[model samples]
Target: MNSSWFRKLLLSYLPVFFVVVTILFFVFFQSLNEQNRKEAIKANEFLTQQIVLFTDNSLKTLNYQVLRDTLTADELRFFFGSDNDDVYRNIQATELMDDWKMNNPIIDSVYIIRLKDNFVLGDGSGQAADFVDQPFIQTYINQKVTAGKWTGKRSFRPYAVEKPTDVITLVQGFPHFSTDKSGYIVVNVSLSKLKKSISPMYNPKLTYVRVTDEQGATLMSDSGADGENSVLSHYISPYTGWAVDSGPTGWGLAHVALHFYNIWVIIALVAVLLGVFWVVHVTRRNYKPISQLVSLIRTSALINPYKGQSGNNEFGFIQGALEQLLEETSKSMQQNQEAIILRKKHRFQEAVEGIVSIRESEWMADLLALQVNPVGAHAFVLAIEIDRYHQFIETYHRQDQSILKFVVSSVTGEMSGLRDATTWAEWITDRRLSAIIWVPDDADGEVLSGQIGEQIVQWVQSNLSFTVTIGVHGIASNLEEIRRSHEIAGNLLQYKAVLGTGRLLRPAQLEGSEQRVHDYFGTIHGLSQSIRIADGAWQKHIEDLFSQMQDSISSRKEIESFLQFLHQQLNRVFLELSKDYRSVWKDSGAELLELGRSWETLDELKQGCLRVFEEMASKLQALKDSQRTRAVISDIRTFIEENYHNPELSLDYLSDQFMIHAKNISKLFKEAYGYNFVDFLIGLRMDKAKQQLLTTERSLQEISTEVGYFNYNSFNRAFKNVAGVSPSDYRKQQTS
Candidate 1:
C-alpha cells in the first residue's frame, strides 16, 4: 500500500515539477535575449554616430577648399578686372571653372555670379541665363549677400540642367576689388560622391544605415531590407542637421531566434528525462538500496541537498537541487563573462605596450580568441594626438575630457570593424591615442591604413570640436615586429611640432622626400647685411628666409641648430652697435630664442622670427635716419661750393636734383650751418665774386655771370647787401 501511494504522488507532482522548470527556463532565456538585443542596438548607435561625423567632416573640408580656391583664384580676379565684352578673359574664367570641376571629383559644377553686371558663368552646357534664373540659386545669393557671410551646406536644384536634382552647395561672396564689382562663387559638391566616401562606414550584412536631412528626406542609404524585431539607432549631425539611422539587417532576428530555440530544446529534454527518472524511482521504493543509489546519483548531478524528514522525498530533493544548480550556473556564467572581458582587456594592454612575455604560440592563440588575427596579416601602428592639447585641456573639465576620449576610442573601434580590419585602440597617454591595426596579407595595407587614419581624424575633428594628428608606422609582416612598428609610430609623432598639427605623417614622409637642407648660412649673411645698413628690403628677405626654413628643414635638431646660429649672428651685430641699439636688439633676439623653444611648427617659428626682425629693423632704420640727415646737409653745402658760378644753381634746382623737399632742405641747412639755404648760396657766390674781382681783370658783367647772377646789377646789389659794399669795393677791401 505504501509503494502504490508513493507512485501516485510521483505521477501527479512530476508533471508539475517539469512544467515549472520549463517555465523558469523560458523566462531566463527571454531575459538573456533581451539583454543581447540592447547591446547590439547600442553598438549600432555608435557606428551611426561615427558615419555622420565622417561625412560631415569630409563635406566641410571639400566645401571650404573649393570656396577658398574659387574666391581667391587668379583667373577669376583677371576675369573681373577685364572689360565686360572681353571674350579672352571670359574664356579663361570658363576654363578655370572647368579645371576646378575636373580636378575635384566631388565638385559637380562650378559657377560665378557677378553682382555688378548680373553676369553668370557655369560649367554646365546651357546658357548662363538658365543658371541665374533658378529660384533656389537666386535665394541663396540674396541670403548670402544679406548675411554678408559664407553660406554653409544648403540643398538646391542644379542650374542649367534639363532634369534638376537636389545638389548640396556652398556659396561665398568675393571681396570686391578696387576696380571690379562684387561677385559670388557657387560650388556644387556631388552628393553621390560624398555618399560614396562614407559608404564604407556601414556593413550591409550587420546593419541598414541611412542618412536623412532635418525634414526626414533620405540623402544616402545602404541597399538592405529593414527587418522586423530590429532595434533602431540614430545619430544627429551638429554641422548639417542631418540624422544617420542604423538598424540590424534581415537575418539578425532570425539568428537570435535560432539561438534561443536551441537553448529551449535542451532545457525541455532535460526536464522530461528528470520527470521519467523520478517516476521510476518512486515505483521501485521497495528496493531501498536502489532508491538510495538513485538519490546519490541525482545528488551528484545537483548543486544542493534537501534537508529534514518532510522535505526528504524524491520530489523535494529534485526541486531543491535543480533550483540551486541553476542559481549556481547563473552565477558562474556571469563571473566567467566578466572574467573573459577583463582578460581580453589586460591582454590587449600588454600587447600594445609590447610587454607580453608569453610564448609566441600562446600569444597568437590568445590574440585569435580575442578576434585579433595576427597570422597572414600585415600589421601597423597608428599614433593619434590631439591638436593643441593644452588648449583642449583648458577648454574642457577633466570629466568631459575623459568622456571625449572614450567617444574617440569607440568611434575608432567601430570604424575598424566596418573595414574588416582587426584593430585595438587605447589611450596610451592623456592627450594621445594609439591603435594597432592588422589587415589581410593580400590587401593594399598602406592605402587601407591611410584611408582608415584619415577617417578617424576627420570624424574626431567634426564631433569633438578639435583636431588630431595621425602618424603611421611602416607595415610589418609578423606579430613580433608590431612592437617596433609602434615605437616608430610614436617617434613619428614628434614631427607634428615641426610640420604643424592636424595632418597625417607616414614613414616615407619622415625620410625627407619633400624636405631639403636649407641655406642657413646664406640667410644669416643676408640678415646681417640688412641689420648693419638698415636695408629697406630686410623685412622681405626675412619673410623669404623663414618660408624656406618651413618648407625645407625637416629635422628638429637641424632647425634648432639653425635658430641658434641666427641668434649668435644677431648677438654679434648687437654687440657692435651703440647701447640704445644693443638694448633693442637684445630684447628682440631674446624673443626669437624663446619662440624657437615653444613654437609648435616651423611656420610659427618663422613668423616669430619675422616679428623680431621687423622690430630690430625699425630701430636700425631710426639710427640710419639720424646719420642720413647730417650727410644730406653736408652734400648740399659741397654742391653749392662747386656750382656757385652757375647762374641756374639755386635751392629749387638742388631740391629737384636731390629729390629732397625744398622746405626740408632749407630747414636742415639752417640747423646744420646757422644759415638758410638761400643765404648760404648768396654768401658762396659773393665770396667767389670778390676773389674773381681782386685776382682777375674782369668786367662787372663777366664777374656777375661767373657768380651765378644773370645781370650785373643783381650781382652788384647782392654783393653790396651781403658785404655792405659794391662788388668792386668788396674786391678792393679783400685785396687791402
Candidate 2:
C-alpha cells in the first residue's frame, strides 16, 4: 500500500517538474548554439584577416616596383648619371633613401643589385652575386622584360626557417636608363619586417589566425602550433595564392563553457536574493531623512519664526537647525531692510542739501569729506538718467530688474576712479544716477564738466546703445554753497537748449561771451562772418574752443558742465544763424533747436550742446574743398605706416583720429592715389614684401604672411605687380 502511494505522488509531481526542467534545458541549449555560431564566425574572420595580410605583402612588392621604376626613369637617368657612376649613385641614394623609408620602412635595403654586371650599391649584408639568381629576383627580371613590371615574395634560398627568422624576400626589378635596360635596380625587403607591419590583421582577441601556402603547408600561426593539421592548415591567404583559417577550438569552447557556467550561475542566484533584501531594507529607511529635510525646507521657504532646532542624530539634524536659523535670519533681514530704507531717505535729503549723498555707498561721506572739502576747490555734479528704463523692464520682464541693477552697479564701479579725488556717484532714484566730482580750485568747471559729459556719452554709445545726459555746475569754493552749484547744474540740465543730448555741459558754456555769441546771432554778424572769414579761421576758432575745453577738464562733472556751456552758447549762435540765413540752415536748423528742447533738465542740456557741435561739424564738412580733403587723405596714409604695429589701429580708427568721415577719406584717397584705399594699402604692403625678400632670408611663406597676405597666390600676384618679378626671382637677384 505504501509503495503504491509513493509512486502515485511521484507521478503527480513529475509533469510539473519535467515542464520546468525542460524549459531550462531549452534555454541553455539555445545559448550554446549561439555561442558555437559566434565561434564559427570568429574563425571565418580570422581566415579573412590572413588573406588581407597576404594581399598587403603582395601590394608592398608592387609598390616597390613602381617606386624603383620612377627612380630609374627620372632621378637616376637625368640627375644621377649612368648606373656605373659610383659618385652619382651614392649621392642620389643618400638624398632619396630618407624619402623611401618614409613610405615603406620594411624595405631592408635599396640598391642597384645587378645579375650579369655583378655589382651592388647599398647598405645590405651579402654580395650582389649572392642575390642575382634568387627566385624572386630572377622572376622580377623575367617579368619585367614582357610585362614591364615585376614584384613578389620569396624566401632567401640559403636562409634558415626558425623562430624569429627572416621569412621571405620582396624583390622588384627596375631598368637602367643609361643602357638599353641591361640590369636591374632592386629593392629587397625582409619578410619578418613585413610580418610585423601587418600583424594587426590577425587579432588574437576574437579569433585564431593561421597562414597556409599553396602546397597546403601551414606557414604561420598566432597560436605557434607546429603539429600536423595545425590552425594554419585551414587558413587561406587571400593574396599570393595562400590559405588561412581561424575559429575557436574545441578545447577553448569547453573551457569557456566551464568557466562562465559556474561563475555566472552562482553570481546571478546570489545577486537576485541580495538585491531583493537590499530593496526592502532601503525602501523602509529612505523616508526618515527626506521627511525631516522636507519639514526644514518648508520652514525656510516661507517666513517662519518658530521652527525647532535640530537634534544630534544623523537623520536631518542639521536641516532642522538650518530651518531655525532661517527663521532668525528673516527677522534680522526685516529689521535691516527697514533700516536701509530710512538711511536712503536720510541720504536723499542730504543729497538735496548739496552734501552729495552717494546712494548704496557706505564710504561716500568719507570720500567727499577728504576730496571735496578743501577750500577754493570746485565740485561738479552730473545727473545720469537712463531713458525708458520702465520700457526696458516691461520688454524684458521683471526678472531682468536684478540684471539691470547689476549693470548699473558695474558702471558705477568703473566710474569710481574719480572717487580717488573725493568724486562719488550715487543712485538717487530708480533709473536716475548722480555724481559729485571735486576739481582743483583754479580749474575751469566747464572744462571738467565737458569731459564728464563726453565720457558718459562714449560709455553709453560704446558699451550700450543707451542715452544719458550729464549736467555740470560752476566751480564752488565754499562747501556750504555747493547746493547752489548743484541746483544750477540741475537747472541747466532742464533747459531745452540746443546742446548734446547725452553729454556734459557747464555754466560758462551755457552763458558764453555775449559779443561772440551775437557774431552767430545778428544778421550783420552772419554777413561779416560769411564772406570776410579766412580760409580756415572759423574752423580754427571752433577747434580752439574744443581744444581748450579738452585741456581744462579733469573730471567727468567738469566735462558735462563744459559741454552744457558749449551747447547753450552754440544753440544761441545757431538760433541766430538760422534767423539770419533761413535759406542755408533749413531742417538742420530746426533739428538742432528741437534736439535742445528734448533735454529733460540742465544735465540733458549739456548733451544737447555736444549734439550741436557734432551737427555743425557735419555741416562745415560740406564746405571743405576736394583738394583739402585729398591733403587729409595723404595725412592718413602717413599715419598708417607709423601705427602698423597697433593692431587696434584700422581705417576706421584713422578716420576717427583725424575726426573726418571714413567715406570722405576713402573718396579722397581714390582721387589722390588712383586706387581704392585698401588697394593702396596693398601696394604699401607689397613694398614691405620686397624689402623682406631682399633684406632678409625669410621663407617666401613667412614673407607673404609678414606683409599681411594670408595666401601665397595673392602675395605672388601682388608682388609681381609692385616689384616686377616673383618673390623667388627677387630673392635670387638680390643674392646675386
Candidate 3:
C-alpha cells in the first residue's frame, strides 16, 4: 500500500515539474533570441557604414585620377583636343581607357564623349548610340550641370548586349574634371566587382551585405544567405545616400548564440531532473525495509540521524540546497563580471547621447556601481577622431582598425587618469572615440589646452600610422549639461577642415567666428563683369571669394554656403551672356566652379579656384580674339573670291586689301576655314577650272590662264593636285 501511494505521488508531480521547466526554458531562449537578433542588427548597421566609407574613398581616388589624366596624359590630349581626327590617337586613347578599366575591376567600362563633335569612344570600339546609355549622356549634355556628384544606380549598357548591366556612374567632365565643354569621362562601376572589392571586409558565410545606390535601388548585393531573415540590419548612408541591408546568410555567432543559451537551460533542467530522480530513489530506498532505513538516511540528504532532531532532515536539505546555490551563484557572478566593461560603456554612451535623463541621482548610483563615477567633481567630454579617415581605413585591416581604436581609448583614458580626475573612454564610432573626465571645479585652464589631448595626439602620431584630432567643450557644471558638452565637442571636430587636423581644438577657438558678416554681392558683380571682358581681375575675384570665406566662415556649412552663393553669382553672370560666351562657362567654367566643391581648406580652394579662373580667362580671351578675327577673315574671303582670276593674288595682296597683316590673314583664314591662303585660292581656281573643263570645252592653256595660275604647267599641276588627275584627262573623263 505504501509503495503504490509513493508511486502515485511521484507520477502526479512529474508532469507539473516538466511543464514548469519547459516554460522557463522557453522564456529564457526567447530572451536570448531577442538579444541575439538585436546584436545582429547592430553589426549590420556597422557593415553598411564601412561600405559607404570605402565607396566614397574609391570615388575620390577615381575623380583625382580622371582629372590627372585629362590634364597631363599626353596620349589623350590629341583625342580630347582638336586633333581627334588622328585615328591612331583614337586607338591610343581607347587603349589607355582599357588600361584604366583593367587596372580596377570596379570600373567596368570607361567612356569619353568629345562635346565638340558628339563623338563617343569606349572599350573594344562600338559606341552603341541607340541602346548604350547614350540617352543619359545626352541628358547631361543638354542640361548644364555645375558639378558631378555620384549618380545612383542605372542600367548601363556599354555595348548593345542582350541584357543591361547595373552600374553606378561617375560623370567627370574634361578640360576640368568638374565642368566645361571639352568632353566627359563617364566611369561605370560594376555592382558585382564593387561587391568583390568590399568582400574582403567581412566573412561571407556569416553574413551578407547589400549596397544600394543614391536612388535607393540595389546596385549590388553580395551573395549571402538567401532569405529575408538573412538580412538583420538595414540603414541608409548619410554620405552616399545609399541603403545597406545586412543579415545573417547563415548562422553566425550572434545568430546561433541563442542555441547556446537553450543548451545551458537544457543542462540545468537535466540536473534538476536528476535531483528529482535521486529524491525518488531515496524515498524508494526508505521504503525498502526498516532495517535499511538508517543507512539510507545517512547516505542521503533526507535526515541527519546522529543529530537526533525531529527537523534534522530539513536542516540537511537546507544545507545541501545552499551549497548548490552558492556554486551556481559563483558561476553567475563570473559571467556578470565579464560584462562589467560592456555595461560601463553602455551607460556612458547613453549619458552622452541623452538617451537617459541624468538629472536624477539614479544615474550617479548606476555609474558608482559601474565604478566610473567621481565622488565630487565637474565633467567635460572630449571628442577624438581619426584624421583623414579615408586614408586610415585604406591603410588598416579590420583587425588593425579595432586595435587602433583600442589604442585611442586607452591612451585617452591613461592620459586623463594622470590628472586630478576620473576619466573613462569608449569608442563612440569606428573612426571616433569619446572621453568623459570628471575633474575638480578648480581645475587649471590647461584642461582645455596642452594637457591630455595634446599628449594623446603626440603619442598617436608618433606610434601609429595615422594621427588624430581632438575637440573639447567647456566643463559641465551640472548633470544635464554633459550631453551638451559632448555635442559641442563633436561639432568642434568639423574645424579640422579649416584649422587643419591633428591638433587639440577648444571652445575658445570658435569665439567671434559666428558674429562675422560677409558682403559677397559687390565682389560677385565685379567678378562677373571682369569674366565677361576676359579681364585678369576675375582671377583676383576668386581669391577675394576665398578670402571672404576664410575671414567670415567658421564652420563647414558656412563655407559650403558661401561657395554655393559664389557659384550662383558666377552662373548668373554667364547665363546673361551670348551663347558663344555662355558656352565658355557652360563647357569650361563649370570645371572651375567644381574646383571649390571638395577642398579641405581655404588655401586649397584658393589655389584650385585660381587655376580654373585663369583657364576661364584664357578661354574668354581666345574667344574674343576669334570674334575679332571673324569679320576680318570674312572680308578677306570675299576679296579673294572676287579677285581669284588675278594670277598675282596672294596672302599679301589680301592683307593689303583688308589692311590686316599677311601672317595674320593666313592664321585667321586657316582658323576659320581649315585651309591656308594658297590652298584656298587653288581650290577656288580649281572649281572654276573644273566647271569650264566639263562644260565650256575650253583648252587647258586658256583654262589655266582664266584661273589664278598664269603658267599653264602650274595651273595643270594645281588642277591635278586638287582633282587627282591632269586637267585634260579630268575633262575627258567627264565629257565621255
Candidate 4:
C-alpha cells in the first residue's frame, strides 16, 4: 500500500514539475528571441543611415564637378565673345564639353540651350541629337531657370551616332551678358552610369536601393529590381527627400513586427499547459500543509507524548503555526510574480524611449580630458582606416580573424596606457584611437604636437610589430575645431615627403600654412608698392594690409588694391631694367601683361611673379631668351579666334602672316592652351555647329561651310569626334 501510494504521488508531481520547467524555458527563450529581433532592427536602422550617407556623398561629388564645369564654360572669354556662325559656336561648345567629359568620365555629356529659342548645344556620341521643340526640354528649361536649382532626370537627345540613352540631365538657365538670349546649361549624366556608380556601394543581399526625384521617378537604382520593389519608396528620408529601406518587407511597421506572430504562438502553448498544472499543484500542495497541521494537533491531543499539558504545548502550537505560514507564503509568492511582471512592463517602456540623461555637472566624472575644458584647448582627431578590411575577411578563416582582432584590441588597450590630467587617450572607434593633451595656452603648437608624436612612437614600438601610418592634426582651440584641423592634417598626410611610416604632422607646419602666410605678406608688399613714396607711412600701411588680408582671398574685387600694387611694381621694374637693356624691359613688360590676364587667383599671381623673377635672373646669368616671341605668340592667339572661319586659316598661314616658324608657332600654341592648332580650329568650328544646329534652320551643307569646313566628309568626321554627333542628325532632335 505504501509503495503504490508513493508511485502515485511521484507520478502526480512529475507532470507539474515538467510543466513549470517548460513554462520557464519558454519565457526565457522568448525574451532572448525578442532581444535578438530588437538588435536586428537596430542593425537595419544603422544600414539605412549608411545608405543616406552614401547617396549624399555621391551627390556632393557630382555637384562639385558639375558646378566647376558650368562656371568654367560660362566664364570662357571666347565662349561669350564669339560672333561667328551659330553652328561654329555650338560646335565649339560641344568640344568644350568633350574636355569636361574626358576629365570626368562619369559625366556623359554637357550641353547648353537658349531657353528663348530652345537652341541646343552639346557633345554627345550618338544619333540622339539635341531637340529644341520637345515638351520635356521646354519644361526642364522653364523649371530650372525659374527655380535656380538643378532639375533632375529630364529626357534629352543622346548623341548623333548612337541610339538614345536614358539620362538624368541637370538644367539651369544662365543669361547672356549682351543679348536678350537666355541660355540654359544642361549636364547630361547617363542613368546607366549613375546606376552603375551607386549600385556597387550597396550590399547584394539588399532587395534594391534607389534615388528618386520629388516626382517619385527613379533616378538611380541597384540591379535586379523593378520600380515597385525599389527600396527608396519604402522609407521616408526627411533630411534629403530620399527614402532608405533595408531588411524584411522594406516598409516601416511591418518590419518592426515581423516575428511577433511566431512568438505569440509559442507563448500561448506554454501558458495553457502551465495554467492547468499550476492549478492542480496549488490545490494539492495547499491541502497537504493544512492536513499535516491538523494531524499534529490531533495526535498531540490524543497521544499525550508531552505529558499532561501536551494538548497545549509550545511545540504543538508552533508546529500548527509554521504549517499555516508556509502554505500562505507560497501563495503570496505566486501572486507577487504576476505583479512583478506588470512593473517590468513600465520599466521596459522607459528603456525603449531612450531619454536617459544626467545633469551637466555630473558629466565631469565621466568626461575625458580631451572633451572637458576644451575652450582655448588644443585638440586633434585622427581617423585610422584599415585598407580593404572586407577583402581581408574573405581570405582568413572566421575564427582566425576573430583571434587577430582580439590580439589587436588587447595590444591597443595595453599601449594606450594610463590617462592623466595633462594627457588622455580614447578608443574612438573599432579601428582608430586618439590621444589628446593639454598644452600651455600660448605654447608653440609644433612643439606640443611633436611631444604627442614621441609618446605615440614609443608606445607603438614597445607593443605591436606591424607597420602603421599616423596622421596628426595641429592644435585647435576646442574639440569642435578638431575635425577641420584633422582634415587639413589628413591631406598633408597624403602628400609624400620624408615622412616615415611612423610619421607625425602639425598642419600649421605644412606648405599649406606657407601659402597662407604668403598671401598675407603679399598683401603687405602690394599695398606698399601701389602708392608713391609717401613719407613715414610704412607702419600705417602695414596695419591696413593685415586688416585687408583678413577678408576672403578668392574674391578678386576685394583684392583690387593688391592687383594695383602688382601693376605698379611691374611698370617700375620694367623701367629700371630698361636702362641696362631696352629689349629686356620690353620682354619683361610683355610677360607681365600676359600674366595679368591670367591672374584670376592668388596662386596664379604667385606663379607669375616667380616666372618674372626667374627670367630677369637669367639675364644676370648671361642667358639670351626672347623679348618679341612672347608678344608675337599672344597676338597670334588673339588673331586665330577672330578669324578661325576663313577657309584659308592654317598654322602655316598664321606663321607666314606673323613672320615666325610654323613649328615655333605650334609650340607656342600648345604651351598656351594644351591643344594642337588643328584640334583648336576643329573645336572652334564644332562650338559654332552646335549653336546653328540648335538656333537656325540652316541645312547641314550650309552650316559646314559657314564654320570653315570645305568638304562635307571632313566636317562630318571632325564633328563626330568633337561633338559626338553628325551635323544633320544633331539638328533634327530639337527641344524648345
In terms of lDDT, which candidate is strongest? 3
Better of 2 and 4 by TM-score: 4
* Residue 198's lDDT in candidate 1: 68
Off by over 4 Å in 4: 1-7, 24-28, 74-77, 80-91, 103-109, 115-118, 123-133, 140-148, 152-167, 175-181, 210-212, 215-240, 249-265, 268-736
Candidates in order have lDDT scores of 0.73, 0.55, 0.74, 0.55
**Candidate 4's TM-score:** 0.34
Position 92, candidate 3: lDDT: 83
What is the alpha-carbon lDDT of model 2 when measured against the actual structure? 0.55
Q: Which one is best on TM-score?
A: 3
Query: For candidate 3, lDDT tens digit of each residue in 1-736?
Result: 3888678667756755765676577667667676876776777788877887887777778767777887788776778775446788888888888878766668877788777766787742444354366778777777655446778877776566546777778776666644456777788888777777889988877777877666656677766546565666677766667777877665657556634666666766776777577567765665556445545545765433334334434334556556666766898998888788678778878888888667658777877787776734677788998876776777889898888788788888778777767777888788789887877656763454358778889999899888898998756766678789899999988776677778898877766664344456677677778877887788787777656656654577776666677677778878888888888788655775566455655676667767777787888898887787897788888888998999879877776777888988888788899989888888898999899988896788888888877789888777778889998898778988
lDDT against true structure, model 4: 0.55
lDDT by residue for model 1 over 230-254, one digit each (tens)?
4378788888888777776666663
TM-score list, all predictions = 0.38, 0.29, 0.48, 0.34
Off by over 4 Å in 2: 1-207, 210-248, 251-314, 317-322, 325-332, 335-426, 429-486, 489-515, 518-736
* lDDT for position 630 in model 4: 64
Q: Which stretches of candidate 1 lie over 4 Å from their true place?
A: 1-377, 440-444, 477-479, 494-500, 510-518, 537-553, 627-736
Rank the candidate models, highest TM-score first.
Answer: 3, 1, 4, 2
